[model samples]
Target: MEYAIALVVLAAVVLVIVVRPLLGSAGEADRTAELRAELEAAKEAKYREIRDAELDFRTGKLSQEDFRRTDRELRTQAIEILRRLDELD
Candidate 1:
């Protein structure tokens, strides 16, 4: 009976050791997925800002020089967001 109890305890320990990493990895995957989604949303928002800036330029709401500067800055930000998204992949 003592040997049986020891065997059961050993089995439980081995099971936990094997399963712990799988559970940890599942959490990691969820976090990565959440991060990817946030990055994608940011990318889309940046794209929308670029489009709005262009519309303002076309409508003469923005001066040529100011529009150019805004466009460059927006593009640079968009590129960085893209780079981060790529790293996640």
Candidate 2:
């Protein structure tokens, strides 16, 4: 009977040790905030590139064909980046 009581106590201690971390709330919020910031920065950079390309085209710095090609490329890149962000979420 005494050995059984000791065994139960030991089991209880081991259980607590193994389960404490699982019981606590993990740092999910911090990770989400970091991911959101990264997404926001990427979106801003993508838009900035598009705007710069448009301005250059308007100023006659790029021909119409070149502008259309660059516009397509930038839009495709932006879409891919957004798709990756969706996957992360």
Candidate 3:
């Protein structure tokens, strides 16, 4: 009886160990998807900011030097975000 009990316990433990990675990966996949969505949203927001800045420049609201600096900074930030997303992939 004791041997049977031990064997059952061992089997349970083995099952748990085997299944843990599968379960963990499901959660990991969800997190990765969420991260990708967030990254895309950020990209869209950055693009909108650039477009608005361009509109302001065209309307003569922003000085040429200021527009250039702002546009460069926005592009740099977008590039960094893409680099990070690449690393995650």
Provide C-alpha RMSD values for all models, in order: 1.2, 3.9, 1.1
Q: lDDT per residue, candidate 3, 11-31, as tens digits?
A: 999999999999999999999
- Minimal lDDT window, size 10, model 2: 21-30
Residue pairs in clash, model 1: none
Candidate 1 structure quality by residue, lDDT tens digits, 1-89: 99999999999999999999999999999999999999999999999999999999999999999999999999999999999999998
TM-score of 3: 0.91
My TM-score estimates for the predictions, one after another, are 0.90, 0.66, 0.91
Clashing pairs in 2: none
lDDT (CA) per prediction: 0.98, 0.90, 0.93
Candidate 1 deviates by what RMSD? 1.2
Per-residue alpha-carbon lDDT of model 2 for 1-89, expressed as tens digits?
99999999999999999987765535666776788788879988999999999999999999999999999999999998898788777
User: Relative to the unseen true structure, what is the C-alpha lDDT of residue 59 in candidate 1, on a scale of 0 to 100?
Assistant: 99
Could you say which candidate leads in TM-score? 3
Error of 2 at 30 (Å): 3.0
* lDDT at position 60, candidate 2: 100
Off by over 4 Å in 2: 1-29
Which has the better lDDT: candidate 1, or candidate 3? Answer: 1
